[model samples]
Target: MKAVLFANTDWYLYNFRRSLAMSLRRQGYDVLLISPPGPYGAKLRALGLRWEPLPMARRSLNPLREAALLWHLVRLLRREQPVLVHGFTIKCAVYGSLAARLAGVPARVNAVAGMGYVFTSSQMKARLLRPVVRGLLRLALGGRGARLILQNADDVALFQQAGLVDPQHIRLIRGSGVNCAQFALATRTRSADDERPRVLLACRLLWDKGLDEFVNAIRQLRLQGCSLHALLAGTPDPGNPATVPEATIRGWVAEGLVTWLGHVDDMAGLLASVDVVVLPSYREGLPRTLVEAAACGLPLITTDVPGCREVVTDDVDGLLVPKGNSEALAHAIRRVLEIPGLAQRLGEAARLKARTQFDEHIVIEHTLEVYAELCDPLAAPAESSP
Candidate 1:
């Protein structure tokens, strides 16, 4: 059997869906990866899977370029003739699905990782394009033997209400699952001399990620006589329009407000070194960093938004502050610091939640089941629209 996985970038494929691709390969399928070429493309090739570079502009809106992209995908799909075609992110899910149908692929899976900039942004451009994008999504997602995988129930409901997809075609699988074994509980002892707790925010440095708010919150805490080390990890995405410039990040680091650690590969080590993990993102499909941090037994502080709320029950696994409110975030951080046993309690609960619900194996098993059902009709009853 042959399967092709399409994504917006090589980095996303290597980082998020590497385990899933390996799982499929282990199951005796010849898996092919398609994405724009990058440093990570070589890593995918090194994993012993065939990697094909597909030139795609992730944020471009030019009609001629988009037409060429669709045509390229259609031709490539026709040449490969894979049994299953899986697409990740918005562009891949939309264009890929349409291309796969045109190529007569047997089964299709479109993973809507997040609503992304178009849905998240309140700009005039976003508002104008919303209806057009919705129409395209409806057309792309409407076909036989096609399934839509959403990371959160909120996204599923939004798409359903917009008439972009049928309820039965949607599957809520949570974030790309975290490997509990790899991100096991941190076992580090702090010295008596060091009393400050380490707090971290790990995500792509995007404006929409609320980095400014996090910095302001840190400043607020410091003014109130709270002493803690704040760290910002992850690289800025040049492809994204909302990317935080390197100069801005450097300025923050230079001012001693927060330590900027660019593109951390040793997340387990980083989590082990930190007392709390925070993601004040405006929105997300599901934030993987928070889930990984939870698996590593670190307490969390995040916004009370869709993806953040999904991972944390306020005051249960973590604290949830109002989105875009730096003062609220500051207060929550102080509360976590001041309270004697709150962090410990939240970390314990988070670890339990990650192990039970967001384990990598659970996600893999569920995804494989979907693939099985798609490949063999008799394996499960056909899903119907509600």
Candidate 2:
């Protein structure tokens, strides 16, 4: 059997879905990947997976370009003639699903990782395009053999309410799961002589990720005489419109407000040195970093928003601050620092939650089940027409 996975960028496929692809390959499927070429394309090829480069403008709105993209997808799907086609993220999902239907693919899966910029951004452009995008999504996902995978229940509800998808076709599988074994509970602890607590905010450096809010919160904590070490991990995504510019990140690092650790490869090792993990993102499908942090037995502090709240129970496993509120974030950080034993208690609970619910094994098993259903003889039939 052959399966083709489509994504916007090679980097996304390498970083987020590599494990899933490998798992599928191990299950005796000829796994193929289709994405825009990037540095990671070679790396993916090196892993012995077939890689096809397709030009994709992730944020472009030009109708001509979009139409060309759709045509290119239809051509590729026709040539590949794979049994199953899986698309990740919004644009790929919409275009890939439509193209798969046109190519007469047997099965389709659209992973709407998050209601991205069009849904989260307050910008006028995003607002203007929301309805149009919604229409496109409805048309793309309306196929009979298609299944929609959502990372959070909030997104599932939003799509259902918008009449973009039926409840029966929606699957709520939490964020691409974290590797519990890889991020096992830390064995080390801060020595008695070490008075300062270590805090980390690891995510793509994007404006919508609340990086500014996190920096301001750290500044507030420092001004209030709190001596804590703050670490900013992950690199800026230049292709993304919301990316925090390199210059701004440099300025912050130079000012000595936070240590910049760009694109951490060993998150498990890094988590061992930190007392708290924070993601003040404005929104998410489900923040993968928070779930990984939980697996590493670290307490979390995130906004009380859809994706963040799903990973943390307010004051139970971790603290939840108001979205985009630097002051509230600062207060929460201070509370985590000042309250003796609170971090430990929260970390313990978080680790338990990770083991029981958010492990990668669970995600892989569930995803394989979906694939199995699609391959089953009794699976839903394909729509007669596109």
- Candidate 1, residue 80: how far the Cα is off, in Å: 1.0
- TM-score of every candidate relative to the true structure: 0.95, 0.94
lDDT of 1 by residue, 134-214 (tens): 888888887668889998878888888888987788888888888987888446656478668988999999989999999
| lDDT of model 1, residue 159 | 84
Quality of model 1 by C-alpha lDDT: 0.88
Best candidate according to TM-score? 1
Cα deviation at 317, candidate 1, in Å, is 0.6
Q: Model 2 has how many clashing residue pairs?
A: 0
